[model samples]
Target: MSFATPLYLCGPLREPRQMLADQQYSGHTSIHDDSMAEKLGFRAGPIEGPTHFSLFVPLLAEIWGQAWFERGCFSSHFQNMVVEGELVRAFVERPAPGTTRVRAWAEKADGTPVLEASASLGPDDGATLLDERMAKLRAPEKLVILSGLYVGMLGAEDEKVRMDAEQHMGDLYPFSLAQKLEGITENSPWYSDAASTPWGRAVIPLEMVSVLAEYTSKQAAFPVKQPVIGLFADQEIRMIDGPLFVGEDYLIRREIVALSESKRTESYWVRSRIYDASGETLKAEMLLNHATLKHSYADYEAEASA
Candidate 1:
């Protein structure tokens, strides 16, 4: 694995003075809700993991220039959860010129780690964050959402979806890229103002990229039996050819990579890669671990037993 340029390195990237204040987006029954989050032993609805990805984009942009957004990839493994209002900053070890991949991490004001990852660009012929993790994953013998499913299940066919700035991104993300820019806590004009950067237009923020890239996952036939609410236990988004443009059409295809479980939930991990409109250029990809609460599926025991 090699890079087009040196790995990006600079001083710590500090987020804006705002916190992730969108807990209200999730309904009262969702774990992200205050009461439910507290009941589940969290300090508060831990701010969404995707929200933290914002801190690293500027560093990527600075390192690779506007081209990074076009083709940069940031793959990560989250290490901890932090609440709103917590002060966290991103740091990357400056790589030597021509380095392909480098270590990156986010830490609290006190230096406690939040997430650790490998950030890069282009076709990473080398094993990736998810690829290495998937290689060691073991599926549970019993599952609720994934009972009928097995690893390596591909989508029925290649699914094509596009990002429309005016439309809400289904239930999971009820806001559009235009709407998300309204309260963007990270505070980068490059995300919404075309004049702010050399990309010729405003770019999509990482948080909104979650919606643009993944909102259609619900339409996928993952073999989950019941309609259960799910949360992202882990996620990684990587861009291959170029930065995805706002409101532009992109293509996506999903595949079930692995399955696992925890004491309270069953998990299904899927990898979705985004391509350019022509479907020839590899643009971006996301690996998501969707963990559904066992209790949410009323017949979880029956399904697991079967």
Candidate 2:
């Protein structure tokens, strides 16, 4: 059946801090670190993206049953942070039979939608999809790998020295609340009514974390040979330590922790850690199968010229 089937999903998520604490104790440190979030300037531990995505799985199961995982494609952009005591909701819209579109968003008790997402699901046919096509186009040149090679080639010579947060904790991003709320949610009550809730305070969306990670990978090298690929395979939001207030300036720094070649897929895997202004690790990620800029249209042109 397509995602357009008559299926509806709705519910409220538990407290954000409790969830994050569980994730940290369980050794789930790939994303936000629950241990030192407050010290890092967060109101509380922030939730991981993957775990937040799962809020819809139950709804999918009701509609698609066991087949949801087999034929569904899910994608989400972290728009705003759902802090420690917020109530998040999930909804689905079915436009056509056998097709379903779902969305999730978190809000304060006053009903401000902080984070939002939309996903589509339908019958899976045995054919290559756009994502696969892109992968094929990216495979031959390996731009991501080449970028890593370039970094290694520099060997500390070109290392971009970053300011340590402990020594310089006050540096912030300076994004205003009004600006941060822009394009996030429509007529958000938090913005219009000055609503308060047990959810603490509004923070930056978790989706921004993903955006930062993608941007950092892009800036790690020069000449822009290959574009970084983002995979939302599995995300887990562990905590929402503190509020990332609007107009508050925050600093982010990334460091590559591990790089290795995959034996099975012959792809390169890169892991990076993101820290906030306090020098406390806010998020850590292991990006798999990122392509490097080894060859491009220029290489093809060179061959033609040769």
lDDT, candidate 2, 1-306, per-residue tens: 445346445655444333334322112231234454454344655554443544555555566553443344344444455555565665554334455555444454567654454454543322223233223433323333233343222112111223211121111212223443343322234222324423333333333333333433434442323322122322222112232332233444433322332221123333344334554634233232332222222353353345
Candidate 1 residues 1-306, lDDT tens each? Answer: 866664545445354322223333224345565666676667776666777777887777666666667666677777777776677888776767676676788888888898887777666526667667767876586676777777788877666777666777665565666676665656577766678777676677776677776676655767776655567777878766656777678878888888998888888888888887778877788888888878776787776677
By TM-score, the best candidate is: 1
The candidate 1 region of ten consecutive residues with least summed lDDT is: 17-26
How does residue 262 of candidate 2 score in lDDT?
A: 24
Cα RMSD, each candidate: 4.6, 16.2
